[model samples]
Target: MPKPKIELHVHLEGTVRPALLADIAVGNGMAPPAPSPGRFADLHDFIVTWNATTGCLRTPTDYRIALLAYAEEAAGHGAVHIEPIVDAEPRLGLDGWADVLAACVDAAAEARERYGVSVGLTPQVFRGQDVGYAEEAARIAVRFAGRGVVGFGLSGAEGRHPTLPYARAVALARDGGLPFVPHAGEAAGPEAVREVLAMGAARIRHGVRAVDDPDLVTELVERGIVLDVCPTSNLRLRVADPGRPHPLTLLHHAGVRCSVSTDDPALFDITLSDEYAVAAGLGVDAASAYAAGLAGMLGTDTDRARLVRIGRAAFGGIDVGPAS
Candidate 1:
């Protein structure tokens, strides 16, 4: 059996199977974007493709189908727990955000029963939009906290919008006991990571660029903030060079906690296991990778304990040390 794992930084819309997207588009009397070379030309290209694909989801039923499909996919890859980011900008409308989130919660409950994979929803605000949108999304996330929504996140064009604008929204999430996890240090740089940190982010998604500043890396280590790093996404987005050593290895060796994830498995054409394989190739052993996953999960205590038991069984009771 494959070793059990936890995935903390995948996106629900990004997990829509290509065939499903085509099916949805055809049924809705819409034209599906033509298939392109699997790799993205740039971040803008990626965002465009991502938006087009997500646009196919028009109802709560559509969201549930996508959620359940992603659950099964992650479970097949040995993910015992997953936190899939859901962008709040509605394909249906602003009111439809509630329906989408409700569907996700229902699908997650069913997924746990069927696949034994615990699911958490992390609703994200598109940074390119106004901060009020973020505040709205954050309030929705806060309302659903512990129901299925486990955290709040900020995603999208990082360079186009600075993190400070969303501070109040992030603060609302923090005050409501939701883990604040925002995307940073990918399209931008280490300073972007710093901005999110100032907003009290418990974890950072794709914070691979923190390695650029030794001081920032040291601060990350000191804070025990986990980074959910997606290696293939970094390469596909051209944020990191494929030929060079990935920042994940450097961050791991520097004592910064890190977890391997497939940010968008379907979109990026990779898997959670594939990410672990890449990490292994870069000299990070399976035990260390699993250890990081355990430490980085945003699940509750019961869920964490379940993952710990699963990990202990799969890795032959190996000493999975503290993340730091």
Candidate 2:
């Protein structure tokens, strides 16, 4: 039986295994930066590393290899489904983005055939990108809807860059029939989460700070938006309250649907399994934590039920309650 896992808030560049990144970078004449001991420092540090890796991914084969490697690692972590957020505007190039996206889809399908794990793409727009860039990505997503692109996401740095600026792109995605999973409350406060809510994000990535605002927590619970929580990633970035003060428990108690994930396993040196263990330590029971993960991220009811069955089989007679 497959180990039950689903990761909804992963970035392909962030997930690149360090060793592979080194090899790929050297091969491309862009030597990877020296290995760092910490997962991440400030957001600026992360962005710098992000640019360095992005520079290495300059070809179709490079994109395919990066994606396939991520799929392999995700499957190893028991991930039945992995949605890699692709910030296509910068990396894939506007003119050749479609071909790059097609290559990614092919990689995903191949991973499923070989590893028994499924993968999907989420065309991600950087929060700092202007409205036109967001609109362009959204238009492309609309053009290729259902051709391996499962959802639309807003990734990258979140701050004073208002999510509302991307409203048109998000609306285009919704009109063209795609789900919105925007990153919020990761670096900012609950007000940032509220902003995404107003912009109609179906899921909130790293919404740990919602606990800081009881009203916002109530709003999230009432609306049933899944908080794509990344405990290790948050700790590594120092975005969340330290240790016990982390909002995983508070969000769970508040009735917000929340899922555990490794936002960037390579950087954090963790995996979905490690993430689950962290959540367990944070007060969620083993079985309930697993169930919360499945419920919070699975794209369909059928998939969610399949995960529940897998959980039951793996844990044996332990009931993993509904994510809701």
Winning candidate number (TM-score): 1
Give candidate 1's error at residue 264 in angstroms.
1.1
Error of 1 at 210 (Å): 0.6
lDDT tens per residue, model 1, 95-122? 7887888889999999999999999889
In order, the Cα lDDT scores of the candidates are: 0.83, 0.75
Model 2: per-residue Cα lDDT over 165-274, one tens digit each: 78888889878877888888887888888888888787888888888899899888787778888887788787864746778877887777777788877767787788
How many clashes (backbone N, Cα, C below 3 Å) per candidate?
0, 0
Looking at model 2, residue 95 earns an lDDT score of 62
**Candidate 1 total steric clashes:** 0
Over 4 Å off in model 1, which ranges? 317-324
Against the true structure, whose lDDT is highest? 1
> For model 1, what is the error of residue 184's alpha carbon versus the real structure, in angstroms, after optimal superposition?
0.6
